[model samples]
Target: MPDKITIGGVSVDTRHWIGGQRVASAETFSDSSPIDGGTLGEIARGGPAEADAAVAAARDAFPAWAATPRAERARILHAIADGVEKRIEDLAIVETTDNGALLRSHRRGVMPRVAHNFRFFADWLLSLEHEDFDTRGHRNHVSWDPAGPCVLITPWNAPLMLATWKVAPALAAGNTVVLKPAEWSPLTASLLADIAAAAGLPAGVLNVVQGYGAEIGDALTSHPDVRRISFTGSVPTAKHIAASAAANLTPLSLELGGKSPLLVFADADLDLAVDLAVEQYDNAGQVCLAATRILVEDTIAEEFTRRFVDKATTLRQGDPRDEATDIGPNIHARQLEKIDGFVQRALEAGARAVTGGHRGDGQYYAPTLLTDVAQDSEIVQEEVFGPVLTLQTFTTEDEAVALANGTRFGLAATLATGDPERAERVTARLVAGTVWVNCFFVRDLQAPFGGSRLSGVGREGGTWSFDFYCDLKNTVTAPNGFTDHG
Candidate 1:
């Protein structure tokens, strides 16, 4: 077993969340590994006090940090990316131990993506250019300003990667940040703070606090000093945060849950569809953009289900650290229980388990595929953040689009088809933020990533993230006579 880790720069004798250089407490909570029911460490049950401290620290640093030159800020981000690359192994181990994600997935899939995000945004900052608009006979110019101190709350499923999605842009836009990492997986956030310090970030520029949502999270979201809040989690939690932000009229960016769909046309490459489906369930379907509701055209539904079931059944589930393991345990026991309940409810509602519906003693659920799930069932409507996919069939293009858009989620969609005209038509009609014509989960950091509707507002990644974290200011100039006449 690994040794217990400490937050901030000092080691505390008692369990408490650390902000800046202080040890504070609200309650005590033990963190356990999902791989086995073994205690990993304990965090100070941080409540309102810790959250306030973190916000204060961010407010204090905002003036200097925001005033810093863009080039200098870009340098710090680049250096942190370098530090992360150097210690990839250590970070991957801690990430897997905390969340039961496969070590290879973290090392290969997540780490590189984060590194690319930093580099891509760093270049964006350096090359940022103001737009000049001609307003009739007057001259107008636009400038982007930071949104002041920001409160960032991230989920456990893809902690580091998702955190980077916000952090890189917020920093690039010159905002001080107070980060609240999910209690289930705090180790990676702590390690990231250490890396930032090594990269020469100013004191209090980035603050991390770990605790329950009701306690610490409420304080951060409601704090007056926090000018903006960016959160990624469930839809219900997002609604609560939205309300809290509304009370203060603070700006927010919420990346809520999704029940994303994948459309398989009759002309789609069958072999490719099966491979993508297997990979979609690779991380146990914890991803917000997991293509869970597979809508296949009736003409090919039989063949696709047969192949999809065959591949999904062969996925290896075991210890996350094992290199060959394809699927690891869920993030926690509670998550496993929630997933089980959803499956059982769907079964009772007349859904049939096509393959792999068994649960192990540990926090592990086999990759499950269900058929004949009612369109309005909980399994189809709710975001099941686990390794489960419910298959449905559609006879026509209009039916496929209707079924895909049935849920409130509009995050992502996958369309596999060999027909070029059909791909173009379906891709244009899909009500999703991202549409993959021939692939699934394949993304580039330079592309804008986000959802259309309840999947969340605003965008992340590419040059768009800079716009999200910054406030656009339009400057207009006119001759004295012209202004007086108007």
Candidate 2:
């Protein structure tokens, strides 16, 4: 491999990292930047052969790495965190250029959080307490065992942060990793692999295989040696992976799509509600946890609509590298077309676009809010995953709960109200795995995080993350007085 390759006017090193070395693929795919639809460069396109090699490398290194002391593993993790912080500016630029998210958001939030994911998991590993029980003069000790090779399939929207969300836990639990990054946002994962190796991570402990998910995902998921799988994507993709892993009985932790709701009560703080409403336009409305379905109490619906439309229309959309840009272009032309289709169909069906409704220059899409929408319109019920919000008015608490829980998805929901009793009441009735009252995306690393219904399969955070990454084994010691001889 060359010392560096030119990508969109920047010299960067992005290649498949296998067995602690950079390996190029026989075939390549063009990765286009959404900023101007310019060709970034030809990315390494891995197939079954590359997938097999990565799995082999991870398998070969698992035994020694798993047996390594936890303290040493944690030290290396902190070192990785250090490397991430040192290169925060570089990673933020690459990620913004690769995925079209605002560079300011990445530098201020995403990159810093990426470092936090590593350091938090590392410290948590050290502070963990194993379960110990003594019953009837017998001792029962529960321990965590590394589950061998793991396959981590991450999404494109927030590439490095989400990949490390799984990578950090899997490595801390002593499992070797084979990461399959989204084709659209593959750059930062390669950077992470380099960071890990520089942090004294042993060879083959972490490998990256990049390509289209359709070709490479099957081989990685179906591989017999892979003991664990953690995926974050659409529900249909999760079902396909489940079938592939079923033969090997490989456990999976799937974090799927969402059509989350944000219920605005009549008594809610109007400014707070409108601010939260405008935040859906952040990242071009690509976040899965975004509450795109807005269920508002009819009493304050008129004033709420006016404030929401004003703020959303003013959101800046331009070059992601600009600090002033609040919203960036959609990830690609394909995504932009999809966002348009959803908004257009809704308008044609008598729904009114309160703010934005058309595609802007190039891949940029105008932030949109739709009112007078049918409760069961395809746009209302489906996951558009774009900068479009649907409005529905309800008068009663029961109607709000029903409207929020009416969809098939239950990933997350938001409630804005001052009454603590009502917040608790509505929160209890919302079926989403995570319910945010008076805020959005406020997270604690230790909290149980995942989706309900079609949103996802298993919880991942705190011990839940370790539970998926490691095998829990319970040891029971027999009482000395009643030891039986076989």
Candidate 3:
């Protein structure tokens, strides 16, 4: 709600964060509150020109930033983390208002995780290793180098967190970035730019742009100066970015969609299973790794469904700002419509709505649970991305694994079982980037986060994130003799 958001110690004139400054163009878009459909503010609608300016700024900053020592760069990132910690309440307010995430969750769960991610990556930057390899009289050494200019495209669901997954690492790895935040929720992204600017990141090193994907995203993807693209969004967009990057052979890292499943075994704790199911659906199942499908062992399927439905039915569905509310609205009206269409299609295809299957308004869809969902049904296969949970029964472990891995997405899977051996075995067999044994939806910054197959291309968190943002340069030194010109 500030008149002008500050970034890099500079007060930008525009509402939206773009080109490393506040940007106000003739074109503008209104940011609306999903909870009550209230207008938040009008943000600048950046197109190709803004995208070009952002990319140019990043290109200009890359040389000097990349040349800066790792320790100094790490210090800047650390300062950003400190700023985030200081303004946690303000950032949380903006994020919750814009994205419809629970205020408590944004403050306690999401913001803390983001802070940890930045700090963890900052530590990794200080400890990064470049080894000297000596192989049979060949003195070879390898050093990590920045990837130059990077284009970061983030989604609207977790606007700030997901964007930081790319921005923090790219910046810490010494690559200047042009960040294109999803237009629907640009508040946190803009606020982040303000925080980064206040933390003393060089102007061009971190830039934010707002616009439709076709214009700004296309420009960022096709720009000759951008050496890498890191995106977190739907599979279709990922495919587009991947293809565009392929044309120029620019390196890319994508964390796409997922229809992740949770397998509950006969020996599992039913209470705990129900608890996790409710928790995973807390953000209305908008999270990428949300346990949308639950494949339970036949012996416990009936009881699990009975209890799960009861717990889900008890969830409070209303405004995100309400402390008593357990679930909130979807990010937008179109998202609610999309979710409704999926639910209706599933019902038409003989799926039984075990519980809620209705929409309250343009943004709020009732927390829903569907049973008897066909294996090939769109609701089961595609990413509904709403508070809709589908159930299927499996007789054996093999069947459970098959059902869990049935979808093209392999983002995450959860196994709830008391048997340690079975948990380990099922964890290995489940084809997902992150597997939760006896739990679901829990993660740490130290853990490497990403998915496999159509889920994504590269890891996002931990030390491995540097791999996506930096390239390796190998050098060889002769003991005393000369080197070959070739």
Candidate 4:
């Protein structure tokens, strides 16, 4: 890697994108890369005033943006996709450098999806069917219209992708957005503003504000002008947003964290199960939907634990830039210490580490597994958000289901079993937004993504997202031949 990552042969923007321009402020914060603890750049410090300006701009632009023809909106989204495709490498580098995600994974796995999100929503918009019904006494037409100015707050991990997941559909539905990216991972989001502008996104249609949440989160989420708020982060933060949004009776879509379970049945393919478990270490297990809980059938638990521990020990941890590196450092020193705390506490509580345990050098924690953990313990019930996996055994499928749903979160769950009938049955019983049968983290763009209970309030992707971003209205008309005979 070089001294600094650049985009378009220039130093990347680290300021807020508000009112169709990059706004720099004297008050700023240092953005550091997790790779080597180097300062990446300084980002603008935005507070209530900045958020107000962005919301005002979006509110001003909403009428015209909302009225823009579906075809025209689709065309602009396609252009944005094209712009992203052309600069895939530049954007990918920014994401990896700022967020410490693996460059190899992002370039190949995430960049394409960035463009695809726009395309997917754009196409979905054009193909949507406006409901029209003809009856003997009256005619009725139901249509979806933009919900007006909205707030989109994204988290640090997978900032670009998660923001895109909300922004694409919101824009496609013609809702102007004031996006506040997590302060730690603001570079790539800043680049997206340039891409959108280059693609002809009208001024004030998409605004980005970067700062600490405490500085701007309340003002953004509670603003009367913002009709909707979509957030992806911790459950505690979501609750705060919920209370603030309620001040305006604003609709909110919250995708919170999870302690998701990956069930390994007695009849599961052991090799495949091991492979999936290892893959969960991607992003150092910072992902909200990762399989943090490894619940295996009692009959096969011992064998599975041995294989899993051996495989985890082999995973290389180093600088993410290295193609051979399997696990990168946590986002920051604080996260590393947090992971260490969880592991230490579990060990002290009598849970045994199967293989790798303890924190390594410089924000790196070895992939850890803890067996003999109680079902109700903090290690098993809480979201560690690290590469630490808690192992638990279940004697029956009922027990597996109970253990999986024991946590406050119900974001997602995965099960590996040979019997299709049993898979579907268990899937139905699990109270989660998404369920995977014999697979891990498999997503379909058209399928709804979210959680039940505290995982999230509303679904995203496909029609569900469109519904959230748009307000539905029904128009009732008099019969064709009937005039207004007041």
Candidate 5:
């Protein structure tokens, strides 16, 4: 389009990356920076044509790429990781300017993990060995064959990190990928496409088509040629994608919404508990695993609420580019309004805002903590997806578990307790995919990750990732070396 736009001092190209080339769209949309609601640049507005083209390219590339040696694929993945490490600063700045996440966190934590996503998957792939066993005089060999063309859809929050989380595993499993990033922050995905190309990825192995879901989602997810789909977003959209994918019965993995809880036991460390509770405000509470609903034991509920409010109020909200700022603005004006509405409605329903309950200048909203909330109210049961926390009191271990599992969402939960036995006892019973004991937001990439019930449909991490990206085939041979023992 127009020469090249400088975003946060880094040059950016805003075109769809398909078949290892930059392709322009018939129409374009102006992208904005949430920092000050300023126009960043014109991004290609892709439609069905682009989506079809990307899938076709992926389909065309799958055979040769899948046939390539695993070691060579691993080498290419390492190269991609190297490219990501080299451009961390530029990637972090462009992501922050576009999505309104804290720049410092991006530079320090998010970007590094983005690189590790590729490295870890590559190393994990190289170490894996499919087992072959004998069954009644026959040998059964287990193999994970690469599935064909696939589609990956990621959300706006933590765009690159999450996209690469899916992309790394899919690519490592030898599947061709057509990544459709969220419309809100699509720039970095374009950058990543270029990185993969520079890292010696074959044409059409990795493609990016950026557009609004309404315009391009159906085309990508509903394509009959798409063998697998991985999506991370809201429940409604997940349902939409599922419906479309069901036509071809295409296998899909969904990582969806949550109204998770952080339970604090009376015997827990007060400092650790308060710190974990306040961390729900990080990323402006845009995280799907955020423990927005807090259940504190009756004995320490008052004190915990007081400390949580004080810490939450201390969070510095401002421009995302500022190193000193703890939280940045909401990604869009509508998101700001939606966040405030949740607080306002809670206030109207007799919930008390102990710290913050209003909006700041531009797209920034105050980190809010609500108390005296009704357990059955929408504020406690629904995912606000904002810088808001709701507190309730629980008298015993059973009550705490009940409150933690109260919502339909079983995405994640945090339990704070001094007793190891209780941590084991209660964490086992909590209805969630992930449980954090005496901690919050500590992630180990090798562990299984996803939600139960409404939060999501499947898990993805380590072997779980490969399981989803590849198909299992068992080869049985009669009279093999070890099969003589019946």
Candidate 6:
């Protein structure tokens, strides 16, 4: 392996960006591409000291940034959008190499979407309706101000996009930020620091700390200067962060893990349902909102299973760089093992793999379909987080809804029904943050996105994001009655 990996025509020896400088640490760790197991490069391993420096930088910059006019903040955000758009291709390549998501999705879907997020949030601020009212002869003025220094911890699944999801709104609301990208995928986040700086974000206003969550995350969340924390990762880790935030009584927004379900009714269009299945398994099924649990009505279960397995068999698992590839490798060796273990356990418990079920070389797993699986089986109950699907049959509408909401997660779900009334009725009963009636994975920039139960704690995107990243202060004024009192 080379001493340094070149991405986007630049050599990488990863370092944290603190106070607008690329700062190195005494300790560092190797970062490799999950695609081919090739070494990407070495990245600084930040400890508490580094975290402290990042928090301190954000703290120093917060007041000035907060005091910046909202219109100016919106302008900078638009500049950020332009910067992101300018480097979209390069950013997409870096993200794909680091995270093993399909290059096409990263380039054509995620990167552009991230740029759009900045634009969306920027326009939202410009079009905002500031609230003011009068009651009891007193005028109350409500306005939003930056929520001070905030720490954003994003997952590796879709590093640039997910990080932007938090960063855009936070910056748009005039908050200084310290970002901790997942160790597994830190390249793009590092690149983002450069983009933001070039877009004219002030020094110490935005910083990127690249390191493992355990060492640096604790310090950032527990830092007294950090007023708010927004994290996207596993439920267990979110819980730990929540605990840490409690020490300072800091506010938090967590978008945790998900084991979402997709239900197919007997009256649904089978072809469309199959298409939805394919969409759910997109991104190698690593998406937190992917449909892992498929509940098909008993009457049509047999045909649905056959068609689903047929479609699953045809999915292409190959080099992520290949635009034609449908499934990419797992993010790491450990993740590959976890996905394999879950499928193996289900097989041991009498689940049948009608099509692809086994692991391939170098962290690649075949798109799998497991039928005849018990609802209580680990494969159905837990998140496999690979291109694997488990099928179960339900005899009644209530039963289908029950199976869909059976998991501890409530991130997202999809229900397919020909009858519009049935679709509405079932959607109302499904316990998820977002429910699609006849489609899967449809998203809107204006819609609020988050989860229920263990999935997440707060909503993001649209106005919800603005609310979370800023503090709404209400001021009241009234006429004095001093003359009458005297």
Which candidate tops lDDT?
Answer: 5
TM-score of each model, in listed order: 0.94, 0.97, 0.95, 0.96, 0.98, 0.96
Output the better candidate (3/5) by lDDT.
5
For every candidate in turn, the CA RMSD to the true structure comes to: 3.5, 2.0, 3.2, 2.4, 2.3, 2.3
Q: Model 6: C-alpha RMSD to truth? A: 2.3
- Global fold similarity of model 3 (TM-score): 0.95
Which of the two, 3 or 4, has more lDDT? 4
Weakest 10 consecutive residues, lDDT, candidate 3? 5-14
Q: For model 4, what is the C-alpha lDDT against the true structure?
A: 0.88
Query: What is the C-alpha local distance difference test score of candidate 3?
Result: 0.84
Kindly list the per-residue Cα lDDT of model 3 for residues 90-202, writing each as its tens digit: 77777888889998888887897777667878888988886677877778887779989999999999888888878888998999988888988877777788888899998
Q: List the residue pairs that clash in candidate 2.
A: none
Query: Candidate 2 lDDT, tens digit per residue, 1-486?
Result: 353556545466657999999888888887888999997777888999999999999999999999988999999999999999998988888889899999998899999999999998998888776868898878999888999999999999999999999999999999999999999888888889888889899999999989987788999999999999999998999999999999999999999999999999988999999999888878899999999999899999999998987787778889999888889989988888888998999999999988889889999988888988888899998998788898999999999999999989999999999899999999999999899999999988899999999999999998889988999998888777565787
lDDT by residue for model 1 over 317-394, one digit each (tens)?
Answer: 899899989889999889999999999888888999998666876899978899988898999988889989989999
Candidates in order have lDDT scores of 0.82, 0.91, 0.84, 0.88, 0.91, 0.87
Output the TM-score of candidate 4.
Answer: 0.96
Scored against the true structure, residue 383 in model 2 reaches a CA lDDT of 91
The TM-score of predicted model 6 comes to 0.96
Residue-level lDDT tens digits of model 6 in 101-175: 999988788999989988899899887666778889887888777889999999988898899989989988889
lDDT of 2: 0.91
Q: Write the per-residue lDDT of candidate 5 for residues 234-323, one digit (tens) a residue.
A: 999999999999999999999999999998998999999999998898899999999998889999988887787777777889988889
**Tens digit of per-residue lDDT, candidate 4, span 1-486:** 222346335467777888898787658887888887888766788898998999999999999999999999999999999999998888887788888888898889898999999999999999987768877778788888899999999998998888999999999999999999998888888889999999999999999998888888889998999988999998999999999988899999999989899999999999999988888898988999898899999999889988987788899999887899889888987788888888899999999988667988777888888888998898998888988888899999899999988998899998888889989889999989998888887787899889988888989889889889999888888776667799
Error of 4 at 365 (Å): 1.1
Which model is ahead, 1 or 3, in terms of lDDT? 3
Candidate 2 Cα outliers beyond 4 Å, as residue runs: 1-3, 7-10, 481-486
Q: Say which prediction, candidate 3 or candidate 5, comes out ahead on TM-score.
A: 5
